[model samples]
Target: MAVERFPVEASHIMMFARSVGDPNPIYHDEDYAKGAEPGGIIAPPTFVQASSQYDPDAALRPKPGQPWFGSGREPSGTPRGGGGGGGGTGLHAEQHFEYHRHLHPGDVLSAKTRPGKSWEREGRRAGKLKFSETITEYFDQNGELVITARSVGVQTERVVEQA
Candidate 1:
């Protein structure tokens, strides 16, 4: 997904840090961060995770009633796993982030996502489960890579009855 721009605000950074229970002053306190290396306030390492939301296209946010990758099945109605919408059967197996440069407030960022890897494994209870990874790379206005994030999502058949 391509976005023209994603202006990063200090408030957004501070809120995200707070939401994640990160009390690091570098993310929220300007005076405190100014003395730190890099000389200014920097966003949290995972702040770029929300870059997808800046896209005009609904890359991450599906329309109402639309199925998402985490919906436990393909949009074509083929079940990806045993889960038939009984409950939350998806799992975030892993997450990784590589910061090539510090993200400062007021920097306009854009991101692109690509399919990373996929595999299947036997589940102790759900029988079989599928895992897929996606890589998103965020770049700044200067066309420099600021962050690369990899997220692994796992889906399995629902073991419980749907309401």
Candidate 2:
């Protein structure tokens, strides 16, 4: 995903912190943060993932007049397939983060993402498993790297059995 401008506001930090069940005063209380280690409010470590909301082309976000992804009258249908070979199931394998510094309010961030390494392997329950990585580098207003995030995705010929 490409993000031209993602403004980090205090309210957004608080909301994100709350959503993640993080109640640290350093995330909400300005005065407490003023004397804390960073000397100011800092967003949670994984808050950078929230940038997806600002990415207009993000696929997970439901637009107006569109059906919600959650269950309503009936259970939400199964998820669609992944990339690589068509009609395969997609799954998030893992996520890694390298933080140069804590995210603070008033910071404007931009992200540049590129594809990483991709490989294929055989699975027990699933047929062929194709693993791919996407790396997104977050830069601050000064163009300094703030966070390096790596997301791993897998495309399986079929859904793996729960173990």
**Model 1, residue pairs in steric clash:** 82-157, 82-158, 83-157, 83-158
Against the reference, the lDDT scores of all candidates come to 0.79, 0.88
Rate residue 93 of model 2 by lDDT. 87
lDDT of 1 by residue, 43-161 (tens): 88778766666777754476567555553444443344444475437767899998888789989988778999899988776646789998888888888998888899888765523
Error of 2 at 123 (Å): 2.2
lDDT of 2 at 90: 77
For candidate 2, give the lDDT of residue 140: 99
Clashing pairs counted in every model: 4, 0
How many residue pairs clash in model 2?
A: 0
**Model 1 lDDT vs. the true structure?**
0.79
Model 2 lDDT tens row, 1-163: 8898999999999999999999999999999999988999999998999999899987788777766645767676334333444445778989999999889999999999999999999989878988999999999999999999999998888767778
